[model samples]
Target: MTNIAPPLVLTVAGSDSGGGAGIQADLKTMLAHGVHGMSVIAAVTAQNSRGVQGYWELPPEAVRAQLDSVLSDIGVHAVKTGMLASTALVETVAEVLAGAGAPVVVDPVGVSKHGDALLEPSAVDAVRTALLPVATVATPNLWEVEQLTGVKVVDEAGMREAAEAVKALGPRWALIKGGHLPGEPADLLFDGTREYRFTAPRHDNRHTHGTGCTLASAIASNLALGADVPDAVARAKEYVTGAIAAGFPLGTGIGPVDHGWRQRAALDQSRS
Candidate 1:
């Protein structure tokens, strides 16, 4: 007899040497949700808690070949994309996923945790036109929301408008993360007719390095496991909140949230 799972998630993103965000964070978030995760590296970044120093975007053929290899065998239940550095890479990935027929979570990553540019200006239109239209949900930070749609989000109120602007791009849903705003950390999800707000008390800790990647990956995992978009967003928000509260200090600069904080708790409970 064989026991097999029903769903799997694919992350098409970049490698973060720092392990705080990008591909590393996506995989960690998937595992934390009890889902199998696979990745296609689109770029390699020299990064740390402080910032990104350098990056190299992989060739489009290499990116497509990786995606094809994964899809031909292992197969995917859902897909999430982040840090596609160039217009060409974005087009290639869009073409591949367009036929993959899996629910996709597109995180239009514009800047890093330390405010470094991750996406090229030339890629913005490609991302909006090619990638987002095929997405089940488009997750963008406030900065990204502005860059992609010219929608400025200064508060929770502005998130709705930003989400609508992003939804106009063709995604079924848009999650505009409001953690960058002053006050509590809140996220807004809009799907044309309805809106949902996910709010949590802002943790004072300065170690939130991978929150965006983590949230989007978590949502993708849930979707792969058959949860609907709103439910997925709600659960991802809760998980990230816990991770933030349990974040650990790493390098001398900003640090990463604890992706396996739940595992640590379970271990402590067993010992007790």
Candidate 2:
């Protein structure tokens, strides 16, 4: 058999002990895209379906060491970032990611599904100044948009305004997730010169714990496979839409979007 290696993608994020989000979700999403996934754990969270109990970030030097170990050897085709809990961690991760040749997908993860703060308020400015500038694409949900850009996204028009605000912060592209909006879930992507909007039927499932992390990682995987920014977002939109539909309850609280839902379906059909 020919030894063929898959496209490699890296997720620089926190670890979710619950296995629903963070580094776990990112790696699962990457595998669903048929790419190799690597991780640099910036923090560790004691979380479950109900909520995040507590978290601790690794030292800046430790973070830098892990990043260097990965990028210098196993080298990634694309990168994705999530949950740098504090300002110093954010700055450290930003400095490390600033020079990587791969495209970077920055997910401004603010809180967990159960409303626990993941990134500190003080880190918001660091994300805007040090991190967003290095992003090939920045993914921010409505609440995060408000947090980072101070833009109140009240309606579709507000979504556009938020995208512009995020673009102004220096990312090459902005993906303003309007999933919190009423009716259907939609996301708007803008790159100054052009824009793309993606909408999916709102699934009634409440198990959407890792949707943001999964979507951002999927985009990184697609980018690693050589898709352009807009196309990568579109493909990720489709994947996450299906994952949302397939979401199932895990623990007492909101569960997770099924990363292997497609494969699970196929297996079920075969057995049937």
Candidate 3:
């Protein structure tokens, strides 16, 4: 009998000790999308449902070594990056990824769910100059859009401007997430020439801790599975919407969207 291997997806991000966001969420989302997830932890955080207490970044050389190890041996079909805390780490990862030959999904993680800072302010410029240029898709929330490009998105009408601003920063495609807007949650995708919009009913759930990481990982997973940019973003948005709707409370703070909501839903349906 022949064995088939699943597509390999890599995540370069920080580790959340709470297991709700960052590396943990990335891997869980990848699994939910049926892809093999590999990680190169850039930083480690003493974090939980309440907030991030502190974070320690690994040495740049160690991060580079891990990237080389993975790229040289196992390789990758797609890559997603989140919370690369410092300037050195951002530049190092960007250098390696420039030659990785895989679709890159960048989640410009600036702050945690509880408003704790994730990326250093000094590193923001590095992210724009060194990292975004290599990204196949750059996913930024409204706040991140302003942080990166100074384009503030207050309504759905402003998403197009934000997406264009992000695209001008050098990403092949820019996805401006408008979940913070007043109405329904919507995201705009732009690649200079073409545009796409993805929307889902706004869930009133507050336990949406890992939404950003989950969405980016799902996009990477779909890309690894051979979905084009628009198709991947569309599928990822759908999956994350379901997860958010099924979100359950955890600890005393915001919880994570259910990464395995689809699986649980399937099992429930079968039993019924």
The model with the greatest TM-score is 3
lDDT of 1 by residue, 1-272 (tens): 99987579999999999999999999999998999999999999999987999999999999999999999999999999999999999999999999998999999988898989889999999999999999999999888888999989877778878989999999999988998898878888999999999999888888999988999999999999889999999989999999999988998999999999999999999999
Give the alpha carbon lDDT tens digit for every residue of 1-272 in model 3.
99887999999999999888999999999999999999999999999889999999999999999999999999999999999999999999999999999999999999988989899999999999999999999999988999999988778999889988999999999999989899878899999999998889998899998999999999999999999999999999999999999998889988889999999999999999
For each candidate in the order shown, give its overall lDDT on alpha carbons: 0.93, 0.93, 0.95
> On lDDT, who's better, 1 or 2?
2
Error of 1 at 79 (Å): 0.6
Clashes of each: 0, 0, 0
lDDT of 2 by residue, 1-272 (tens): 89988999999999999999999999999999999999999999999999999999999999999999999988889999999999998998889888898999999999988989998888889999999999999999999999998899988877889999999999999999999888777899999979899988998899998999999999999999999998999999999999999998998998999999989989999999
What TM-score, over all chains together, does every model reach?
Answer: 0.98, 0.98, 0.99
Ten residues in sequence with the least summed lDDT for candidate 3: 151-160
Q: Which of the predicted structures, 1 or 3, would earn the higher lDDT when compared with the native?
A: 3
RMSD of 2: 0.9
Predicted structure 1: lDDT: 0.93
